[model samples]
Target: MPTASGSRARGASDEEPLRPAFDGPLARRPAALVARLRQRAVPSHWSSWSGVVSFGCLLVLVVTGLLLALLYDPSGALVRYGGSYSLLRGVEMSRAFASTLHLSFDVSGGLLLRQAHHWAALVLPASLILQLATTFFTGAFRRPRQWSWVLLVGVLGLALVSGWSGYALPDDTLSGTGLRIVQGVTLGLPLVGTGLSWLLFGGELPGTVIPRLYVLHLAAPVLLVLLVVARARSALRHGPVQFPGPGRTEDDVVGFPAWPTAAVRAAGLLVSTVGLLVLMGATLVVSPVWRYGPSSPGHAFAGSQPDWYTAFLDGALRLVPPGWEVVWLGRTWTLAVLVPLAVIGTSSLVLASYPFLESRVTGDRRDHRLLDRPRDVPTRTALGVAGVTVYVVLWAAGSADLVATQFRVSFEGVIWTLRAALLVGPLVAGLVTRQVCATLRAADRDRVDHGVESGRILRSPDGGYEEPRDALGAAQRWTLTRAAAPAARPSPPGSGADARRG
Candidate 1:
């Protein structure tokens, strides 16, 4: 019943047609949205940078690995090497080894890429470990972030597998020795031993192992990429955990945002990591295949050792007592191999499930966005130290032969000593670490309840002298008192109350 102009006016007045709800931030005032995103907070702690370092190392590994994969052959078929390296002029080696030599000397910057790849592989695991350690110590693996911890553990396991597979791909003497050891271990299993060995090797000791390892080497990174992406998404969903401090709480994070601040810092870290790796590659030598020559079944040299990251497992194998086979149900059981595998597997399982286990034990179902100080959780900190002690002792045991030779000690004595330490060291470390953490917690309690001593003596009118004290700032007070541990009861020695009582 309205006129056309009136109708138009009525339509115009009907709230401007909604515009599809802006289709997310992109369709909105994108500039403003971006500004808001840039203002988002991240944790400013140094430990927070560990994730950045790990991701950067992973990127470097991928780039260098892709470049190296272009030229390196994976065939185990023997061929005569005719490369420019004078030492190995006419040596018969696997096609894999020949191609490795060709890539090292014939291809431009091949050695650099190889070395960089190796270095990045090494650094990736180290950075991941650092991330895990920081997350564990800070109690950041609670509640919603539990799966994030599991993903990290999976990534680390894959990294180790990828590294060991790559090591076997070079087909050098050292790598062949490693492969031989792997074969022996695989064949030591009970029922599935032969099947897995045949599946892996395709025949006997070095039979087509290089190609299979190449497949694993390639596939591992792809899986790693998937897991890393998943972990990042999970982290984004859960948000970053922050250390407890003034105005910081479980409800919010306190630091730089992702857009320009965290992004710029992460970019800088990536550049520095890549540059350092390149520099090391240019100057240092790693896994020189030409020097080691082609692998033969009987060509293992004494003093050859696996990479540092795998040293713990190697050390575990070394620490096992020999002649540990048992005849059970008419089948010989290799207890030496089985025992280490069982122990390591159990330890890894414990580590991966620790957050859930702790939560279950403590009945703490609440979400945690604020991190705990190590001293605030003495038992947990002690357990972590104990685990680390076990790993260190085992790692040291890997180089038992070298230690014996270098330090002028008996090999048997060195092995026995490490075995004893492996049993006793963790207990000692746990006790000491727990006592230290308790002492620190008590100190924190004292600092929070009573001000710190200013070291200035003030004489009361009654002629008794007392040291003045300075009250902590709000931030310091919050940091000291934010921990969940209950405060100590007695006043600390030399405190104002204790001085007055004295």
Candidate 2:
């Protein structure tokens, strides 16, 4: 054996090994090299699963929308030959409604395509509203996301415009009737009615109006997208809002990975598509066409119902006192135009200012991880429902003619009843809802301090009563005993979180 000095000199391969460093056997590789790397990527939290479903539905809308555009003639074109004065005259004409008729019966899959487009137009708005309700109920609109909530409400307006416009594209008897209603409402504006009508149609009543609407129907959605993009940009500048959950920490939140969430969303989209297809097919029952045949001025479609989203407008139009016309600048103006725009628009604007205005109203700075039970914040939420009720009443009144005749009442009576309900019902409901919420909230507060209410009322021989238990419910018990305060507005803008937002 070599001496100690010699062994040190040998140095266990201070020299190179026989094999290259990377040439080690595959089995010698550590398994974690692959596994560990996979574990650490973007933790896959996919927020907005419902929004993803909505986007998927929008995808279908875009495809169907394009087809409708191709089929529709936006020229306000009309068919005329040999001085035939009839609306359907001229065996061959190049007008827009004529083209729609051609598409309805002529195009292969055209009818199916039309039905799909119509169904989607209906479904998207309905879905968006439902999703908003979910967000509202969950109190997902609170804190860091308050502006996002406002943008969401605005999105509903966009959807309403888009749905209404898109629905008008077909210009079928039903749609034509709806268009006539729009013309009537727009023309009903005070002072500038005729000029406004001319500006919109480039002519008088019913001439090329469908084409003009087509232009608007097309433009509105585009404008909506731009607006949504702007609002979303503003939201991103701030940040997305998070919900209260186990995964969330004092400073942050956690959720299932993206892969799982995306998979779930995709699956939901698939189901929606299938369901829509079935709906479109089932709706093949012949649509009644003559009800709203080509514009007949003043002869309102005998039975008219506006699309759900625009129902409120119809309701508003119905409610204004018959003599509600106002005189301004020596010209006659109607509440029909100013009222809907003022009430709906102003209300939306005010609500949109909630993030900022509320902060000013209340001074709260601490980050809130919990949601307020709507009852705890009764006034605002109740007002929200009341606002919606008012809208429903208006939409119901839009069909005053039908309702009056159907029930053997004067159209005027129908309008007044709905108008009364519009003003009173929601407020009453709001108060009742608020009281119920407060009562429930108090009960919940009791449970946290005490245990479940056992409802075992014990009576002594003296007939005095004592209860053994105090309880609430799962939903009630889960909320914080003291409701989180609403956000307050700040004096000026700053880097840190502030309630002030528009």
Candidate 3:
């Protein structure tokens, strides 16, 4: 393990040297672009496809979002419906709500694009999450790529905010309820709560929230594009991480060229993703705003929920005990809102700082290009499993009422059970997952060391039949051995000064 200075000194050895393929004239030349891009190589792995798919989803969202924006009106003015949908033909509603209805039923192919846009939005966060999980489990955030992880975390945060704000754009009863929840949550902060709420709504609940949220939803993509570009530049500088395999070196990546083959393949993936979104949009219904009607404080829908990405917060709120508020020094404090906010904020901080934290804890500062198998990093893998379990559990808790009703159980009992699960689930998951990883690693080691039975019957001197065993081939043995191998230790600096302690 090396200190920060030592890591910096050896940085050049850690990353593959890459040419600036798109600089100067090549970047501006449309004719030679395809050929030039094809010269850059990417890792030939299924995980690499995740980035391509995510980018495709981004394009789908942008195109569909632009179309939807053309017909959207973000005003709070109430208007009688004059378009299709006979049920609400003359019902009065806000212009924002009415515009969504018009887009859904009146405009040609409008509903398809709108629904596709939504489904793509949902897929965007999910894909980013998958990519992040892959990066984390593989320890791809080490050394030169640390900042790249930060940029990715930023992108994911913005995507969540964008999704939440976009989900609130329709101004239906469900959306309005979500907005109210946001307002209350914001207002529960200690000192800045009131001012934050004022800025968010521009006055009070149902005030300028719609127009403000519309701007935020639109602005998120522009920021996302910028951050993604930054992340790409950083990644190129560090080169793509590769898996350990035969004839593979730490100095370079082994994969296909990015231009002709990868570009065409990525394009095909994009087209397929868009086509699937279209199929889902046309054949399935989602977010039926017409059925929910326009936003009204007095009219509460029987069941309401935010999009799946934001449901964890809803779950946290539901799990909080009633009468959890506190009053001190002439001020009221609401733990119901504060607890969820704290959990989310703390979790974000931990995730954003994870790379540096791992480096400090492990005392290893060497640059790495080969990804570690999850089973080889038991502690980190277990932590990842535990975190994911908590997230899924919280998401389920968001629908506690439904669970209670469906199972014919006491709602209070369900809430209490969830609270208990929240406290105990992660500990169990972490320990169990760590043991599982250790066991799997031991099995892999055994397979590599002792080999497998070839199932051939052999007659011994005692007339006993036995199956013959075959050792793993050189390639298979090398692969498993390299995968199970520990990360290389950094050489001590001059004088062996215990730089880490210093």
Candidate 4:
């Protein structure tokens, strides 16, 4: 052999240098993964962004809520407030109210954070409602997505509870009135009403309800996050539902990729949402507890109204006729409370089970990956509109007092009008919406059968005026022609298909 050092160098050169993991195939693997992620298609439609907006609001709520929770005192004990605001100075109030006043006046950025939390709470429910509507109109709840719909409805219910609990945490006059209403509603339950009320309040009206609510309020978010994550994962597993278009099939997805396109858009949306909430907080004053003094069972502020999300329940209660109570089984039954409870509960049950109901009626069990245009399903569209009309009527009824005062109208007259609307509005809306949907579907079919009018008038050889038409593009034509065909009614038992199969 040559020299030992020369032999070692030769061996190393011949075997090739040992490469580190970061420099080997693994190095290119991450890049390849990133590239693949960048190319993964995401739905870019405006309607697809509603869930993102809701999630953005939820994030804002969590952040601001945590910040506020650090300084909040959720106690119902009596305390004397001697804060910066002169109006409520030396006033006897709950610890909750005193801390609220202190946060508003003493702590830096506390009020802004509190208002941001409030605004985010308001926006979260609205966004969830919008998302639910979009899902309903598009038939996204069909087949495998039915569970997702149920999850979304559950999330919405949790949000409503969380908002109501947070609203009560301030222990102000308005919120106190809301809590009293809750206590009454709880106590209105049949047989077990008193026990339930005691369990909830821990004894009496303001006993330990605030502490109980605080626990519930915190627990709601945790459950919400878990449900949301589950919903998101389910959506990813099922893939996104896309609108009908050329080159798009039930099995195909067409949109921008997830990495840069969706990532950038979502980031932009989150920033914009946060900025808007902050601006609202800085400029608008919401729930001024100082003006309301503090919680007291005997006192309630005039013109007080619950937040919009809970307004329907308030309106429902207001709309019930007086003396709607009955004696049954040697106990009193308050139909005023029971009626609204039954109506709202039944409506929610119907809504949550609608997908299955439609499936059974239609008898079409195929997986639906492409969304149905609202016009393609006239009856469903009409039903959704009708339900919305009912909700709007209820929501408006909640502000009946304000409407009466503002317009110099009769309070009873407003109540009566809303009551009538509660009965008649949905029917009218359903009929009109169905007609409109039918008309739109007809127009779409016409557009498909006949090319679009080009508005170009020309003189024919015989000197008659003629208008040229332009053919629709492949995507436009497909969109117009892809409406769901009407389902054939089932043949009578043992009549046609069943007999043939038999």
Clashing pairs in 4: none
lDDT of 2 by residue, 176-213 (tens): 67767676777877667778878766675557666667
**How well is each residue in 1-502 modelled by candidate 3, as lDDT tens digits?**
5455224554556665575867677565874766555556677677767887778778888999888999999988888988879988898889999999889988999889888888988989999999999999989999979999999999999999889989989999998888888888888888999899989898887888889999999899999989999998998778778777654556645666776666787788878987888898898888889889889877766657678888888998989887799998898888888888889889989999999999999998888887888888899999999899889889988899889888999999999999988899999999999999989989888887779889888999999998877998766677687776545423212221111100
Estimate, for each residue in 264-330, the C-alpha lDDT of model 1 and write its tens digit.
8888987888889889889999988777889999889688889999999999999999989999999
lDDT of each: 0.85, 0.61, 0.83, 0.85
| Count: clashes, candidate 1 | 0
Q: Which stretches of candidate 4 lie over 4 Å from their true place?
A: 1-36, 459-466, 484-502
> How high is each candidate's TM-score?
0.89, 0.73, 0.89, 0.90
How much is 395 displaced in model 1, in angstroms? 0.8
Give the CA lDDT, 0 to 100, for residue 120 in model 2. 66
Task: Name the better of 2 and 3 by lDDT.
Answer: 3
Q: In model 4, which range of ten residues has the least summed lDDT?
A: 493-502
